[model samples]
Target: MSYLDPETSKKLVPIGRFMGEHFTGGNWTELGFLTGCDSIVQNHPRLLRSLSFGDDDYPEACLAVVGSMVRNDPDNLKLIEDYIIEHFSESGPNISTIPGLGPTIRFSPTVFKVPTHPQDAKLVAVMMPFGPSFAGVYEAIKSACSQTQWFYAQRADDIWKDTTIIQDVFDLIFRSQIVVCDYTGRNPNVFYEAGIAHTLGKTVIPITQNSADVPSDVMHHRYLTYLNNGEGLNHLTLTLAQRLRTLDPTLAQFA
Candidate 1:
């Protein structure tokens, strides 16, 4: 039960408290236990270091424990899964959930430096590729956000094998200020990328050709609905430009 060192335990104390407050229904004792669990699973330096070094033994061991627990007690397993998924799914729980936990700690696997040059830095990252269906929308975004450098995953060179595509996407999203996610065709990849942006607390602008494409959980948020035709592109450009200006007035000059 006592698997984490002192330092790691200290780091996860806030996460446990936050989970306890928001997810445990005011169960202070449960909060303490969850905090300890969070420390072991998330803040353990040895486990994190092993993960960083591509070692899987520690994680596998943890998973084995979870598997055994599930076999031993299915009801308890459901409870554990529900708690973890409610607050720690997607990119995992972070300091943001706990008000006094200090500055946010980025847990992205690939740490990258933001561009120093003002012009070289990207402002908005468009997650959709430059395909025939999305080309007009892509161009419209560029025209609307002229001052912001936009990026697409397909623009990356194939120098790295296809296995690195997700990593490359993460690198790009991490470096950008905002992310534009188009949910056209119900593309699973786009949904995954949008989730990452949200978990990182990045400003995400969701756009879709059809309302049905937007996921149910995020349906409450504002999104741009557009057609894939000339008229639709024109309207989309105008609407997005207005949104950009509203979000950041400086972008109005470029629009």
Candidate 2:
């Protein structure tokens, strides 16, 4: 039996396609396992809530349904086990085997420490270089968001020489709640950072002075298009501020 119904499977086609295209070396079975868990969580909210609260039986019940989809693939079963364990910091889920029924897996809570950051720090990071052409655009964003108290910043203005540039970029992307990427001139570095932000599930707002600068693969995602002039910059600032408000209602007061 398929893990997902026809409608659910159809809904996941885009996710599967994106993962397959971007994560070339990823394990498809592991993806399927994760997808199955996600499906259950999305479709069966009550069951997921129970699992989240450390209900011992719920995970096993869900796994029974998931197992039916991949039971024939022992490799995938092991991969799923490993994936869960690794994700939960090496404390594996409870597992047992039943005669004629095969193996059963149950959810187990794991405690992991998360590093804390300074309070009220900037949550939005701009992924564009500092140059004459970008100066007006950057200032416009700052002005538009001034009332929200969001600290707008660029990588070059913040990162120090002691740390690796690539690492710093990754850290910034991971920490930021939103990433605004300017794809003007098709800068390779910006492209790479945008990809990282997408992979990390951060909201990336793409903007460009030239529409042609946006890559074909990413064109499907909405972006702000503007000319490299004062009028265009003003329009971008207003549009971007509106978009930010949509994401964070608190910014509405700033408007």
Per-residue CA lDDT of model 2 for 1-255, tens digit only, reads 323334333423433333223322133334554645445334644344544565555544454434443433323443444444344333333221100112333332232122133212256778886688788888877765663555455554676533456766665665676789999999999998888677555678899988899999999999998877889888987888878765552332233
RMSD in Å for all candidates: 16.9, 14.4
Tell me the tens digit of each residue's lDDT in model 1 across 1-255: 223333333434444444333432233234325434433344434444544465545444344333333333333332453455445555433212111334445463444333232211245667874467677788887776753323322222322433566766665565566678888888888888888778766778899898999999999999999998999988888887667664452232233
Q: Could you tell me how far off, in angstroms, the CA of residue 76 lies in candidate 2 after the best superposition?
A: 37
The global C-alpha lDDT for each of the candidates, from Candidate 1 onward, is 0.55, 0.57
Model 2: what TM-score? 0.52
Question: What is the TM-score of each predicted model, taking all chains together?
Answer: 0.49, 0.52
Q: Give me the candidate number with maximum TM-score.
A: 2
